[model samples]
Target chain A: MIPAGPAGAHVRHWQRFTFTERVMRSLFYIVVLIGIVWSLQSIEIIPEFLYDAPQQTADLFVRMWPIDWGWYPKVVHAALMETLHTATLGTILAVAMATPVALLVARNVTRSVLLNSIGRFILVATRSVHAMIWALFFVAVFGPGALAGTLAIAVHSIGFTGKFLSEAIEEAKPGPIEALKAAGAPPLAVLIKGIWPQVKPAFLALAMFRWDINVRESAVLGLVGGGGLGMALDTALSNLYWDQAGLVLAVIFGIVIVAEIATSWARSRII
Target chain B: MDASAPIKPPVDDAGVDRTLIIRSLTKAYRAGQPVLKNVSLKVEGRGMTAIIGPSGTGKSTLIRCINRLVDPTAGEILFLDQDIAKLNGRALRQMRRRIGMVFQEYNLVERLSVIENVLTGRLGYVPVWRAWLRRFKARDIERAFQLLDAVGLGALATQRADQLSGGQRQRVGIARALMQEPDLILADEPTSSLDPKTSVEIMELIAKRAGERDIPVIVNIHNVALARRFADRVVGMSKGEIVFDGPPRDLEDSHLLQIYGGEGWLE
Candidate 1:
């Protein structure tokens, strides 16, 4: 029994979760723990390899030390150029392709439910498949070159760019659009003048972000014959040239850092 | 043939047929719940007619119905020799351009330059490519600058709309509305967002500019004092119906009580 102090208050209690909710959350954690243990038991890790991992890493680093500096001008240079070209060209092409799809996906822009669904389906299909798998497919069709790599990156990026762009478009303020409509501007004019200006900052930021990601992802596309730095690394590993592999890895790490810095600067400037 | 024959519009002292006649206009956002009910009124060709009412009394719906922004569920709105309720597509757009509206929020595109937002008023007259390229005709550009000067925002023409204060933004909104070279102006609570002094100034600017051009204005306002000071006539609304309509000199405490209902705040 609780003592009543005020007319409207007998007992005032608050909680983040109900009793049943807490119990369910505990059960979920328990199930997750059991699943992790089951997975560990099924994999049957070899204790010898696990224990030797640190030493093996140290040995690999020792072999990779004093990397092949001469390899930079010979094999890595052309492959690095090819990788950059693949990413840049793919991003440009994706921008061209994704703009229309983003328009279709934005509910305020495209009114038809069926068209929105189709646009969503396209985004899901492109994004669900990994860029490497796309590279493999394009390699089969195009017979392995920068073209296949470029195509793979472009197709995979359409979903990422389109999804974000459509969201930006949807988030644009409705007030200006309504004002333009009241002014009797045509539908296309409304979009170009009213909606486009509002979403321009977000659109530019998204493009820069996606391009940054594409640079990193396209680096590995050459492993599947997509023609980039990964091809050079693959060749070096097969021949057991740790020095050349080390050069490739160092170049990739440097390029990624550079790309990140450049994109972040550009994003700041744009917004 | 009679139906097709054009009827001559009734011209007042302003020598323009800016007459707006609404007959039984009704709007129901849903099936049996109406926001506006059987409203009928006639506006003259010149001077400000203020519609004063409490919030949610459909003053906005009444004004929006004139531009067909909110589609009316029933009745005929007769303006410029055509029934506004019956227009669609290109016809409706053409009609809307002739009537300028100022919003309570002063909804100028914030990212655009103040002058560019003013030029948007000419969108209905210009081609789409010209708008896209920002290659507005020389006359329109000149006129936009003149309007900015008229609104006392001449120096701020190049600035972005978001950088403006609330009053300045509303001034830009007025300039944009005037840029349409409209026959009629509908101001739905234009001064509601500004301070007391700014509110009086905005009302003065609207009255002066629209009066100079003989463009009749219909303003919806909450401040009865501002309405009385600027509006030649006042129409009062309560619960989706016009409860009173008369000259401001004739409005009294009795009418205010009827319009706002249960108001100790009328002092």
Candidate 2:
């Protein structure tokens, strides 16, 4: 009460400035810098050649219009099916491989520090190479086919699925595990009864999410000779058949949307 | 209260004496610092033995060590003439299946139905493929139903565990433990999360079940009143060491003061 004056007001002002005001100012500067960088990139000022690339892009888009409704049925029935099959086979193989690797990577489950570290490093190595690059490498090794694409997607999915599964396993409640141990449940029994129950919903959700992403990625893997709809789209684009390219893009988009909806519905039912 | 007063029932003395003999037990989380320091205490084969102490006194560690959950750094935990402390892998798992534990939080898998959680108690007994298939033996299922009924949770068996009240979940937890047909029951602060009334009910259930089965029970409890109310024998721990062991009737206010340290909380 004695210090309820201008001096106290000054102290309160400084306190406000040090915490809230300073943070606001820092955020403002970061936003402004990001905006500037984005503007430069968008206008192609940063990459001179991009600035001169508009005429070609516009021509491509103009040629893409004038609907290819005649071929829509075939694209949906065949190409979309191929895409789904690639995603399904890829995700199934990945989930199978990831299951054991995830257990080894999880620090809580693994017990051995060296083993967990090694498993994590392997996952990191697998994930480091992008799926498209993996597809290209596999295509070179096995020759251009759906197998190469499937293996590429599976390898990449393994890294992602294993990392997420391990995290889910690690974060599982310790209560059941402890209870299982006290019950004299074997390590395998504990994993089955204690860990699996807690992580099942999350694991399934992650796997579904990976499958959704794989559907989108599998279409792209074909661009690198891993055969699928992306191969059709790439060939159409290369031949300047913009209407066919547009059809392929629409089909890919439709498949992705459908997969996302289906996976989301499935995930909701699990939990 | 006399520190040397007999705690166990007279009939237990003459029967096939089933006692847990813990000798020179020690546990340390870190290399230099020990959580349980050369702790050793015998538990009678029948009735409830409550280990009462203040927080951080290794009460939970001692109970966990009985089934090798905490894994003692040193000592022999001889249960039925077998050194559980030295057992590993399959032997350890076989030993664990014979002992049951209830937790303070109930620890039921929230996503699982109550019946599924109860069946988990039989996981060690059932084959892995059978468990994976959710094909519990008909007898086991019938026994689980009976146990759920005994716990007054038969009606709620189909509900998910997360849907139950705290007291109800603890009841399910009890049913799950009892399903194991354990030789000994370990309850670590099982009722600490419940209201006073619920706590009493849970403790009464634990005491009654253990008594009916003539199974030994080791409970780590912070509430001295609760411990005194249910415990046949009271083992008072302080700073990872047993300071007093005797009948609950013999645990005087002075002993409580020693076990918990300071008399400010005492009425």
Candidate 3:
């Protein structure tokens, strides 16, 4: 209702937040500040190490000034290829595994509450554990090979890919599905002709994005004894070959940039 | 309105019982409050039957109930020698194949090409693998294109459904409905989203095409004038009950007042 002032004068009043809301917001900000201060007090810092951090960083960079380009042909080349394969294969595996999980998780697609919960459980379980931790677990099982890295990437990606794909499925317009159902199309037919077409672009775009992220994640998998360029870097660092380690870092950085650019371009084309 | 007049069911030239009988149909989304209150309607074998009423009068619900899209809480929907309300699973799907439906929003799959959307009408009849492979039968493809041509959309066969204008999408929707080789058609507010000119054109297309095929069409329409122009029979509903049932020429202003509950909008 519009409020009127005395003597029939027009009165307009607008505030984004009510007084109670403003008070609650102020309380929230104070609590956040207290939490930050409490956390700062808990994590102890060494004053000597903190003071010389810049100097230490400069010394390390100086030791790695001359990158050993010669290391590329001997070891980095094969490891780089292995990293790409892990990312690519892992993504394909993740997409394949996540498709059914996504279907189950989407409320519109799977009406059963039990199935949705199971799907949700799987998504949360796979996603809660970081890729590096997953790599360590798989490396223990697979004995520190490329298989471990691929498995790690795929498992970690299931939660991400399935979540997005299920969201896409749920967001699909129901009009076409209803139209097809009215035409007496079978359940499978409706899914193919109605839902698939609607979600295909989003599916492809998400898959590409997952693959891009997987590439970067897979690159570091070897640090945990899963196979990739990180293994080569591990070897160089263990052997005190700073120049070789620098070359591996440079290569990884370059490849990540390339993967980002390529995936963005491909996503644009698909969407 | 002499609404107590008995409806004489008509048979088509093929001697098929195309009459759709609804007896005391009632629907309640919630337990006690009914959206349709003991509604009953009879759609004869041929020509257009328009259900006209104000919004939320169960016009759309009544049409959907015939094909079992919206299940009636109580009543019988007798069509084609079967009780549509009781059919389940495969039996229900088989019954639905003979009934085609058009929508207010022209619900074509937005990413699918025009011809594919039209072919969706055949998805019920074709094998699932055929739809998956885009390997529809030769005759079905020919007929889809022919129907598209009939709707003046032959040139836009390969275009995505989302790329078309509202009128064009509704044309595709009509073509898709016709492609089913249906015995009956149900259209729920098919032209409510179109402009006046396009609305008229769409109504004309529905009437003409269904007329040529001798298929009975029950359309839920808000535009009383379009219903009068295109429908052979008019069913006026108010508060979930059939208030008037007669020919378009006999739909007087008094009937409109009774159905819509206001004399102000009559002008």
Alpha carbon lDDT of each predicted model:
0.92, 0.86, 0.93
Q: Which CAPRI quality tier does the interface of model 2 achieve?
A: medium
Candidate 2, residues B59-82, lDDT tens digits: the string is: 999998888878899999998558
Candidate 1: clashing pairs of residues: none
Better of 1 and 2 by TM-score: 1
lDDT of 3: 0.93
State residue A110's C-alpha deviation in candidate 3, in Å: 1.3
> Model 2 — TM-score against the truth?
0.87
> Residue A24 in candidate 3 has what lDDT?
100
Per residue, candidate 2 scores C-alpha lDDT tens digits across A141-252 of 9999789999999998888999999999999999878877766666787788789888999999999999999999998777888888888888877988889888888888
Between prediction 2 and prediction 3, which has the larger DockQ? 3
| Stretches > 4 Å off in candidate 1 | A1-22, B1-16
- For model 2, the superposed segments whose C-alpha errors exceed 4 Å read A1-55, A73-76, B1-16
Residue B163 error for model 3, in Å? 1.8
TM-score of chain B of 1: 0.95
DockQ (C-alpha based) per candidate is 0.71, 0.58, 0.74
The most accurate candidate by TM-score is 1
Per-prediction TM-score = 0.94, 0.87, 0.93
Q: Name the 10 consecutive residues with the lowest summed lDDT in model 3 chain A.
A: A1-10
Expressed as tens digits, the lDDT of each residue in A23-122 for candidate 1 is 9999999999999999999999999999999999999999998899899999999999999999999999888899999999999999999999999988
